[model samples]
Target chain A: MPQTLDRRRLLATAALGGVVGATGLGSLAPEAAFAAEPAAVEPGAPDPNFVEGRISKISGHLLLVTGSDTVLHSIRITDGTSIWKLHPTTFDQVAIGDGLYARGVRLPDGTLAADSVWVNIVNLHAHIAAVGRNLLHLDHKGQRIVAHVVPGRSAAVYNGTPAISDLSLLRVGRHVQVLGAWHPDTNEIDIATVYAAA
Target chain B: MAAIRGEVSWFCCGTAWGPCGTAGGGACGTCRSGNYQHAWPNTSDACYAITHPDTCGLSMSRRTCGFRHYTTNLCNGSRVGTTIADCGPQTDLFCGERTCCGSACGSNRIIDLTPAAFSAIGSLSVGLRPCSVDTV
Candidate 1:
């Protein structure tokens, strides 16, 4: 397994090198030397336990949502349901207009009895325009976004390597992807992880 | 048969924190935020029923645990292959949602990758990117 991983990493590195060379993005550097093997699946099926959308209405423990596809979903929150809004929170923390992704069981009435819910989670690909004491200026497409680095929460993965809490390896002018919780009504995000080439 | 084109996003699992504390390793039980893994919309019959890609005119093949799919960021052509660690992206939920870069555009949310996997191809803060999913 280790040998296979090494070979894969080497190939990935070569591929990355080719890309950087072609694009002249000299600042993009490889940070790790390992790549994971792909896993398999059956094909042509759907997952029945997950839901994602914006909270259109919240009444008691039930949430009325309008999916990105315009599908309507009724999600039920139970005592065992875990709701997250930037962190582990309660049902009360969920509000209208908040985006949500839920994983749980679908009841007979079509309501998703959620087991876990993540609110305002966003994953974006952007260029690291600048780096500050504890924040990063990112340019996604044409929009400038501010990503706050939470010391204990923020992590980085360089060149397909294990995640670490270090942010020093990150460089400005390099392209990076950020996984974070969106701060509602703002262009700022609380970063959970920064995927960079190092 | 061919590549599946759509938008890609990221999610957390395993050592969950804050809002992810209750995320518990995904529906497949092996999902972790640090691993090179991803969530597919079709891992089982039950899962398929929820994320029915067919609802949006997409005919996704049902793939179970450990199924590998290569996701390529359409913008930069950067690609990463990952195994299915859980079920996700609720394809129908975000059916018409689109992500784009330059002139390249991808619509719908088809896959949710782990931090380890997503970072391999693109930055996570950009929220979403147009991508192509293939089995190679």
Candidate 2:
């Protein structure tokens, strides 16, 4: 049956969910689809230009990491932070204990401005296996990652709201990019995602 | 939240009023029983803001409630000549014929003027364009 609902209450709920004010109306033209390239080794890691690290802490939204080369990096999650384009995933997939691989223009403060951080240290394809209150369960090549959808804050690529309630729309066969991070205190990933299908 | 892309002329449900797409609670195709619906948020309906408790007005072809001195009414004008019915919050249904009905109220119903033609009974022109009809 076609779903039905009250107009005022539903809109009120969306407002509570933080729907940004509306702007000018316009149609969004679809981008041309293309075949994706195979994964090549993403350069710029473990050096001054890049870094591979296990998450030391998730101090709120900021990420503290100790690099594989034995260096400490403080990463900021500011509004303009460019999440890694390679992984093509949203920030909702990041966590505290997963391994992080980042590439970006490093700041002089010895802390790198990360372009992207791979959660779990390894790349994987995942399907949106399930969704609960605030957690998204994903199956990646026989592995599972529970990604959290951070409310209110707009993710890097998905600025518009996502249709998360009806997870049934997320079929099992769809492939998504997976990134991971580690948390020293809990030694677990705090976020993850099946990258918004490339 | 449906991912609406590019520039599209979306409107309220069951009515041709607007470029309203997802702003406010109107956009999601949700309408209350006996109320109206818009797009986005995808679940409920909003009631029409009416003027004069019985009549309304239309702005830029969309419906709107009353502004200032004009007490909210269901129909735009009570004159015998035909015009549009002004629904509040910027909604107006066009009327077809002219009738000297005792009361000028059109409610939310778009009335038929004659057997062959019809025009809305309330005020048809008011407010600016899209902004009155559509959300961002």
Chain B TM for prediction 1: 0.96
Q: Quote the lDDT for A152 in model 1.
A: 91
Where does candidate 2 stray beyond 4 Å?
Answer: A1-47, A55-64, A69-124, A128-136, A149-166, A178-198, B1-136
Model 1, total clashes: 45
lDDT per residue for candidate 1 within A111-167, as digits (tens), equals 776645668876665688989999999887467888999989888866434579998
> Chain A only: TM-score of every candidate?
0.69, 0.37
Each candidate: what lDDT?
Answer: 0.67, 0.30
lDDT of 2 by residue, B1-136 (tens): 1211111111112221111111122222222111211121111124333212123332122322211111111222211111111122211221111112234312221211110000011111110111111221
Q: Which run of 10 residues does model 1 chain B get worst, by summed lDDT?
A: B14-23
Q: Give per-model TM-scores.
A: 0.49, 0.27
